[model samples]
Target: MKRKTLREEIFYKGIGLHKGEDIKLRLIPAENGGIVFKRVDLEEGKNEILMDIENSFDLTRGTNLRNEFGASVYTIEHFLSALYIMNITDLIVELDGNELPILDGSAKIFVELLESVGTKNLKEDVEEIVIESPINLTVGDKHIVGLPFDGYKITYTIKFDHSFLKSQMLEVVVDLESYKNEIAKARTFGFDYEIEYLKNNNLALGGTLENAIVVKKDGVLNPDGLRYEDEFVRHKILDLIGDLKVLNRPIRGHIIAIKAGHALDIEFAKLLKK
Candidate 1:
């Protein structure tokens, strides 16, 4: 497959998950720029953070990238997941805030935007990491393994002891169509009890019933119910795909993750890189 870029520029403005501020994002086509983030709010040269594993430094609610000069972009996993599935290898992501907007708390918005603008092929070959052997990494109870495969595959498992949710497991052979259908619409979810603390600490300030699935003890607070019964695990797979994209290539392997989050995802990527 030849390298791909967007057919036209796409734009969006939404609430930033961390800062709770309206942020603007513009996706611009590029020849071979790779997936990069340009912070329009910062000065030139100090405003860019190339989406590379080395630049991935934060492991909180989502994956974040920070440049040498300390310029940062938060919650990029959802957007990166869309780019990987869409096979978008080159583009300039212009952001007018510190975080990508948490649109519906899933990759659906970005996926839709990409589909609308479409893609164009370039002369460059597609970049991918074809694994030869198993790469395993673990952090406490969370772990991930990458094994050889013909295409990108993700097997994600999530476990919560809550009454409404116990265990969710899903394995997906990810492609553009599969991603959009199976994973893109699964919104991020959080416990109702954590809302006050998160808000008090200025974290996840943009979270609400509209963007994320707020879980109560016995059910969800979202009146729309669920998009999918197994959405939780599917969203985990989505996050992993985005985190792996930090390797700066498509991952041609089967990734098995158990209760893994941003921190463990970065650790697994480091092992894959070496």
Candidate 2:
């Protein structure tokens, strides 16, 4: 497959989830360079973080990447996930803050933005990762496994003790259309009990019912209900797709994830990278 980049420059502005600060993002087309995040707020030479498993660091709440100079960006998975399914391989993402905007807490907005501008293929070919055998990584009951497959697929299962969200399972042979329709709209969710903990940790400061699904013991707090019946699990699948972009290549495999999060996803990605 040919490497892809955006057809033209695009810009988005919103509030950073962790810092509750206004942030601006600009997408610039590149011929063949891999996806990179540049912190325009920082000094020129030390502000870029290339998306790679090696640069990934385990952070609470979301995925993060740090450059050799210690410039870092947080909460990148949602944006990366949109780029992955869109087949966008090469581009520059410029950010004016340390974290990305948590727009509606899903990839929906990003997907729409990409759809509006579209992508163009470059002259270079993409080397896709084709799993030939089972690759497994487990952290206790959480596990993610990639099996040999001719096409990209994801089987994600999520479980919680809460009555409103006990368990949800979904499987899909992924494509751009399937992703945009079935997965992109699912919003990230969290329980009301998690609010204080997240704030104490300096995370989710910008999160509101508008951006995330806040669940109470009785039901959802959002004025509008879920987009899908199994939106929670679908959102998990969305996160896995974004996290997998750390591999920096298209993957042709069946990924089975059970009760996994950013930490396990990064570890699984490292295994896939090797």
Candidate 3:
């Protein structure tokens, strides 16, 4: 596969889930350089953050990246997941704020926007991270393992104490079609009981029933129910897909994860790099 980038520029505007601030982003095609983020709100020369493990910043709520110059961006996993599934390797994401818009709290909108603009292939061939040996990582009860595989695959299991969601699991070979049809629409979820605490702590300020799946003790708070019966686990797969992009190349391996989140994902990424 050849390196890919957007065929033309596209713009997006929405509210940040954590900061509750309006944010804008412009996706510009790049000739060769891998995906990079430019914080337009910061100093010109020091604003760029490359899409690599060296920049990963573990945040409580989302995937974040910071540069040596102190420029940073939060809540990038959704967008990055869409780009990775689309096989986009070269682009510049220009952002006007510190966090990406939590559009619908899933990768669906990002995937749609990217498809609308289509993609252009560059001259270079694609590079991939092919696992030659098993890589196992365990942090307490949570664990993630990478094993040799011919195609990108993920097997994820999520367990929650809530009655509405006890245990969920999903396994699939990741391709654009599979992602769009099976995982892209799975929205981020939060427990209804946690809303007050999150808001009091200045988190989830922009989250709403429309953008996220709010799970109550009895059922979901959203009028529209889950897109899939096992959406929670699918969204976890989506997040894992994005988090692994910290490797900055397509991966040809089977990633098995159990009860994992952003922090463990980044740690697994760091382990994969070594």
Candidate 4:
């Protein structure tokens, strides 16, 4: 397939989940190459920031990228996930804040925005990182394994000690159709206990029942419940798909992850690059 990018720039704004400040983002097309993030708010004396795996920082909460100029962008996984699923190769994401909008805590909003503007194909062949061998990493009981595949495939399993969500598994062969309907709309979730803990630690300040599926001891607290019965696992898969996009090219591999989070996911990508 040919590489694609937005035909025209699109803008979105929302509150930053961590900074609790208004954030604005603009997506613009670029020539076939790799995705780049430019900080439009920087002063004339400051340098522009770019997003890449090597510059990744703060894996605790979300995938963050920082530059030597001290400019940083956070929570880019949802937008990156949508671009990866759509096979977008080159683009410029211009933002005026340190964090992207939480945007309903899912990639659905971004996907819809991109679709609304339409995409234009560049006259360049798509490139991909074809796995040559099985790469495995295990930290305690959490494990991630990558094997050669003809196309991208992800199988994720999440286990929680909580009674409401004991264990759940989901698999997806990444494609635009499946990604939009199955993965993009899956919102991030948290247990009620975790929410309280995050607040105690002064994190996740923008999270709410509207943006995340909040689960308590007995059941979900969100009035509308889950978008999918297996949303928890699907969201895990969504995160994995986004992290894998850091490869800067389409990836042809089969990924199997168990109880893995941001740290392990980034580690797995780093190992694959080695």
- The TM-score of predicted model 2 comes to 0.97
Pairwise lDDT winner, candidates 1 and 2:
2
- Name the better of 1 and 4 by lDDT: 1
lDDT for 43 (candidate 4) = 69
Error of 2 at 137 (Å): 1.1
Would you list the rank order by lDDT, best first? 2, 3, 1, 4
User: Which scores greater on lDDT, model 2 or model 4?
Assistant: 2
Candidate 3 is scored at a TM of: 0.97
Q: What is the lDDT of residue 263 in candidate 1?
A: 90
Any idea how many clashes model 1 has?
A: 0
Candidates arranged by TM-score, highest first: 2, 3, 1, 4
Q: What residue pairs are clashing in model 4?
A: none
C-alpha displacement of 14 in model 1, angstroms? 1.2
- On the 0 to 100 scale, the lDDT of residue 22 in model 1 is 98
Cα lDDT for residue 99, model 3?
88
Model 3 C-alpha lDDT per residue in residues 101-172, reported as the tens digit of each score? 999989999999999999999999987888889999998999999999999999999998888899998999
What is candidate 1's lDDT per residue for 1-274, written digit by digit as tens?
Answer: 7889999999999999878899999999999868889999999999999888888775877899989999999999999889888888899999999899999999998898999989999998975688889888887888898899998888988998898888999999998888889999998998888999998899988878889998888889999988998888888888888888787677789989999998998988888887
- Can you write out model 4's per-residue Cα lDDT over 84-167, one digit (the tens) per residue? 887777898888887888889899988899899888889987777878798899999999998998988899999988878889
Worst 10 residues of 1 by lDDT: 243-252
